[model samples]
Target: MIMPQQSSKNSGLWQQATLLPIALVAIEILVINGGMILDMTTSGTSDATRVLLMDSPHWFLLTGLVLGASEILAYRFLVKRFAKRPVTELGATGCIKETALGILVGSVLVSLPMLILWARGFWRFNSFAINSGILKGIGIGLIACVFEELLMRGVFLRLLEQKWGAPGALVVTSLVFGAIHLSNPGVTWLGALTIGVEAGFLLGTAYLWKRRLWFPIGLHFGWNAMQAAFWGGNVSGTGKQSGLLDGTLHGPTWLTGGSVGIEGSLLTAVIGLLAAGVIWKLTPREAPEMAPHEAKTPTDEVPDTGETPAITASEPGRQTRRD
Candidate 1:
C-alpha cells in the first residue's frame, strides 16, 4: 500500500511506540518465567513445576503475567486517541451476552444430535466417573485454562477486537484459537468446533465484562488446571496426563472421546453450553465501548492491516514528498 505523509512520519514514532510495551513484556516473561523454569529444573521440581500446576504459585504466576502484559498502557501513550462509532448499551452488552448464550446454545445444539445417536444404539457416551488428586487436578485444569486463555483470549482476541470491531475480531480470533488447538493430539472436527466456539464464548465474556486481560487469563488457567490435573481425564482426548486421576477412560469414542479428548465428545458440547449460559447471566445489561485513537493516512494508501495508517507533513512517505 502507498502511504501518506503523516503515516510516514509516524512510522518511526509508532514502531518504537508499539515495540516499547512488547519489549517490556518479552523481557519480563523471559526473565520471570525463565527463572521459574530454572528453579523447577535446578531444585528437582521441573517434573512438577515446569508446566503450570494446580497450586498457589500458579495462581500468582497467572496474575503476575497479566500485570506484566499491560500493553494497553503503552498503547495509550503511543497511539493517537479517538472515539466510539456511536455505541449503545445493547450492541456491546447484547453482543457479549449473545456471544456467551450463542456458545451455550450452539454447544448444546451440536451435542444433542450426537446424544440421540448414542441413545439410538449407533454409539455410546464413554465418560467415566473418576477421581484424580485434588491439588493435582486443580493444577492441570488451571494450566490449561491459563495458558490457552492467556495466549488466545488475552493476546489475540484483544488485538483483533481492537481493529476489526467487536464482532469481526471476536469471531475470527475464536476460529483461529480453535484451529491452533487442532495441533494438540486427538483434535477432531467435532471437538475443534465445540471447544473453539465454547472458548470464544468464555473469553469473549471476559473481554466485554472486564476489559482487562487478568480475568480471562486467571479463569482460563484455573478451569484447565481443574479439568486435566484434578480429574486425570485426558484433556481434549490426547493422552493420559500425569494428573491426579492417573487412569484411562473406557467405552465408545463418543462417550470417552477415546483419545481425541473431551472437546470432541457430545458431553463437552453440553458442558460448554451450560458454561456459556452461566456467563450470559453474569454479563451486564450495559457495557462500555473500547476507547478510540487518532486516524492518520491518505485514504488511498492506508495499510491493509485493519489499522488506519496516519502520517505527517514531514514524513518520508508523505504524498507531497513522494509525488
Candidate 2:
C-alpha cells in the first residue's frame, strides 16, 4: 500500500525545451518576409533581387541550420536537466548503431502499406524537378529528423520521464507528435490516430533502444525525405518541393493519402506498424533508469542517477541545465 514518489532530481524545470525548432521556424519565416526590405534596399528590379527575396531553397536550408543551432542551445541550457543519461551517453558516437537501425526500422515500417497498395495496383510513380536536387531533398529529410527527434525524444520525453515515468512519457510525447500534424491540408481522425500511435511506438522504442537523440532523429529524417524527395510524393500533410520522384498523387484516399497527405494512407499505417515492431524487438528489456525516490524497478535499487534536474534545482539545476 505504498504510493510512488518521483525523485526530487527527477522533477524538472526544463519546460518548453522541445519547442525550439518550431520557434526557430516561425522566426525564420518572419525573416524571409523581411527579405522584401533587403530587396528594396538593393537595386529595385532585377533577377538578383528576386533571387535574394523569393528563394525558398536558400531560406529552407538556412532555417534548418538556424533551428538546429537553437535546438542545441535548448539541449545545453535546458533539456539536459531532464535527462537520465550522462554526457557521454548523449554523444554523437554514443548511439551511431542505434541511429542507423532506426532509419532501417522506419523504412520497414512504411513498407507495409507500400506492399499492400502495390499489390492492389494503386501505387503510382512520377517524375519531378527542383532547384535543390536530390542531395538537398535527402539533406532536408535528415534535418527534419534532427529537429523532430531533438524536440520529442531529446527534450519533451525526458520531461515526462522526470514525472510520470517512461511509459507515460512515451504516450504523451507520441500523441503530441501526431496531433501537431493535424493541420496538414486534409488531415483525418483515422489517419491522425494511426500515425499518433504508430509513430509514437516507433520513436519511443528507438529512444529506449538508442538512449540518445541521434537514432530517432535520423529515422524521422530518412522516412520523410525519402518518401517525398527521392521517391516523390506527399509527406505527412505537406507536398514537398522535391527532387527525383516528383509526381502527382493519384488513386483513392484510402490508397494514396488523398489531400491529407501520405501518412493518411493505409499503406503508411502498415509500414509504421512493421517499423514499430522491429524497434520494439531491438529495444532492450531494461526500463529507463530513473531516480530512486522517483520509482523502483523490481530489480536492484540505486540512488538518484542524477540524470534529471532537481525540483529545487533553482541553483544546482541551473548548473545542470547549462551543462
Steric clash count of candidate 1: 43
Q: Return the top candidate by lDDT.
A: 2
**Deviation (Å) of 228 in candidate 1:** 2.5
Off by over 4 Å in 2: 1-54, 80-85, 95-97, 128-136, 139-143, 290-323
Error of 2 at 67 (Å): 2.5
Local distance difference test, each candidate:
0.51, 0.62
- Can you tell me which runs of candidate 1 are displaced by over 4 Å? 1-144, 242-248, 277-323
lDDT of 1: 0.51
Cα lDDT tens digits for candidate 1, 139-200:
44433443454445544555555556555766787677677777877787766776667666
The lDDT, on a scale of 0 to 1, for candidate 2 is 0.62
Q: What is candidate 2's lDDT per residue for 94-213, written digit by digit as tens?
A: 466766766775665565565566566676555555546565555466456666676677667865665677778888888888888787766677767666876766777677675666
